[model samples]
Target: MRWALVGLVTFVLFFPVLAAFFILLPFDRDRKHIHPLISFWAKAVLTVCPLIKVRLEGAEHLKQNGTYVLVANHQSIGDIIAILHLSHSFKFVAKEDLFWIPCLGWALWLAGYIPLVRGDRMSGKRAVDQASGYLKRGVSVLLFPEGTRSPSGEIQAFKVGAFKLAAEVGVPIVPIVIHGTRDFLPKGSRLLARRVQVTVKVGIPQQLAAKNNGSVESFSDQIREEMIQSLKSIRSQFKTGELVSV
Candidate 1:
C-alpha cells in the first residue's frame, strides 16, 4: 500500500521533470548538473518509498568521480535507486528494453547509456562497441553481469559479456555485494509495505591484465568468488522460495 502510493506519486513527479528536460534539449544541450539532479530526485523517491536505513561500507574505497566498470550482484529494482543515491558519476549499461521508458528513456540516451540487447548478435555487438568506446571517453559503466535479477536473490553465474567489455576497455572492475533488497522488493511484487534494511559492500577494484587472452576469464571468476564470499547469508535468504517468471 505505502509503496504503491509512493510509486504513483513518484511517477507523477518524475514525468514532468523529464518532460522539461526534453523540452529544453533543443534550446540547450547543457546537462552537466543533470546526473546529480536526477540522483537527488531518486533520493526523494527512496525517501518516499521509505527504504530502510541503508548501511554502506567501503564507500571510501570508491573513487568519487573515477571511471571503472561497476559489477554488482543482481537483487531487485530497489538496487537501482540505491545505486543512484550512492554513486557520483553513475551511468549504466542496461537492457535495450529500458529504452522504452518514455521520459526516462530519452534522458538515459542523452546521458549516454549503452543499451544491451540479448540474443541479437549484431545489436549486442553494436552495444558492446559503444560500451568500449564510452569507457575510453571517461564514462563509467554499471553492469549486473548476472544478466537478470536473481529470482531467489541468489547470486547466479555471471555471463562473460560485461567482463569482456571491461577487459577490452582496459578498465578496472569494482565488485559490489548487495544484501536485503530482494526481501524488500522482489521481481514482480507490487506491494512495497515492508521496511527491509539494506547493505551495500563495495569491494576493492580489481584491474584486469591487458593483452592477455586468458586473464579476462580469470578476473571474472575472482570477482564472482569475492561477491559470493561477501554475501553468504543474503544468498541463504533466497532459500525461502522464488517466484520464477516464465
Candidate 2:
C-alpha cells in the first residue's frame, strides 16, 4: 500500500533527525529556532508523500509573541503535520501518547508543548495547570474543541477546555479553519499516493476581553460561535469543490 511505503519512509528519514533534535534538548540554547526546523522537516517529508499540497492564508494576521489560544477544526492525520509546518513556535496541547512516540515526544517536550491523557479529566486538569505557564511565557496554545477528529469530515461541536484555559490565563483566542486534509488522508487511510491541495485560513483573532472572570465562560462561548461562523463560511466552498487559495 502507498501508506505503508509512506510510513516506512517517514520512519527511515525522520528517526535520525528526531534523535538529533531530542539530544539537543538540554544543551540547545535556543528553543525558538528549533520549532521551525521541526516544522520544516515535516513540510519536506509531506511534500514527498505525493498526496498533498499545502497552502496558508492570512499569515499576516499572526502577531509575534502574542499570548493566545488557537482553536482549529480537525480533519485527518495529515492535519497534524500541516499545522506544524504552518505554525512557528506555537505550543499546543496534545495527547500524552506523543511523549512516548520516540524522538518526536522529546522534541515536543523541549518545545514547551503540554500533554494530556485525554480520556481522564485529571489529565485535563494537569494540562491546564501546565498551560498557564505557557500563557505566562506568551506562547500560543492550539486547541481543537471537538477533542477528537470528526468522523464525517464535518464540523463537530467543540468542548470548553481551551476556553477554560483562556479564561484562567486571560489570553486572546485565535480561531482558524483548516480545509481539505480529510479527503487526502483521512481517518483510517493509508498512503497519499496522489496529490491533493489543502488550504488553511487564518481568521480574525477573537479577544477574550472579558471584564471579569465571571464573564469568561460567556465570552469564550461567543468566541466559539465566531469561530464556527468563520469555518462555516469556508466549508461550503470546500464541499462544493470550489476551493481557492487564500
Candidate 3:
C-alpha cells in the first residue's frame, strides 16, 4: 500500500513537470533553470513517500560557487531518491537506456543530463566530453563510479570516468556516501518499507594533485578509499543511533 501510493503520486506529479520541462528546453539552453525543478521532483518524492527518513551530513562541505564531479556509492535505485536529501545542485550522468524511458527519459534529455552508452567506446567518450562541457560551464555532474548498484550493498569497484572528467576540467571531486537505501528498497524489488532511515554523507571536495601530477587511476583509488571509509563510519554510527550531525 505504501509503495502503491508513492508510485501513484510520482506518476501524477512527474508527467506534468516533465512536460513543463520539455516546453522550457528550447529556451533554457544552459539548462540552469531546469535542473532545480529536477531537484524539486526528487525532494517531492521523498516528501510524499514518508516511509523513509533521510538525513544529510557535510552538505556544507560542497562549494556553493564551484563546479564539481560528484561521485557516490550506488546500492539500489532508491539511492536516487535518497540523493534529494542533499541541497546541492548537480546534473546526473546516467545510462543511455534510461534516456529511452518515456517521461523520465524525455525529462532527462530536456534537462541536459549526459547519457553514457555502455560498451560503445565512441559513445562513451562523447558522453564524457559532453559532461566535461557542463563542468566547464560550472554545472556540477553526479556519477556513480561503482558503475552499477552493489548486490550486497557494499562499495563496489570504482571506475575512472568521473575522476578523469574532474581532472580534465580542473574541478574538485566530491565524494558522497549513501547508506541504508538498499535496505529501504533493495534491488530486484519494488516494495517500499516504512520507518526506514537513509543517510547521505557528503565528503569535502578532493582537489586531486593527480590532476596536475599523477594518473586518474591513482586518484580514483584514493577517492574510492575515502568513500569506503566514510560509508563505514556512517554505518557504525547508524547502528548505534548516533549518526546525527554535530
lDDT of each: 0.72, 0.71, 0.80
At residue 162, candidate 3 shows an lDDT of 90
Among the numbered candidates, top lDDT falls to 3
Q: What TM-score quantifies how close candidate 1 is to the native fold?
A: 0.79
Lowest lDDT sum, 10 consecutive residues, model 3, at 237-246
Candidate 1 lDDT, tens digit per residue, 1-246? Answer: 877977776677676657656766676433324566566666666677665546577877777767788899888876766766665565677778766776456656665566877777887788777767667877777889898889987789988777888777878888988887787788878666367767777888878755344677777887898899889854454455431111
Per-residue lDDT, model 1, residue 86, is 63
Superpose all Cα atoms of candidate 3 onto the true structure and report the RMSD in Å to 1 decimal: 3.0
Scored by Cα lDDT, where does model 2 land?
Answer: 0.71
Task: Please report the TM-score between candidate 3 and the true structure.
Answer: 0.87
> What is the Cα-based lDDT of residue 230 in candidate 1?
83
TM-score of each: 0.79, 0.80, 0.87
- Relative to the unseen true structure, what is the C-alpha lDDT of residue 232 in candidate 3, on a scale of 0 to 100? 88
Q: Which candidate wins on TM-score?
A: 3
Q: What is candidate 2's CA lDDT for residue 210?
A: 37
Error of 3 at 95 (Å): 1.5
RMSD of each: 5.5, 3.7, 3.0
For candidate 3, lDDT tens digit of each residue in 145-186? 988889898898998889888877899999999988887788
Candidate 2 local lDDT, 118-192, one digit each (tens) = 789888888887777767777677877878888887778778778778867777777777777887777677755
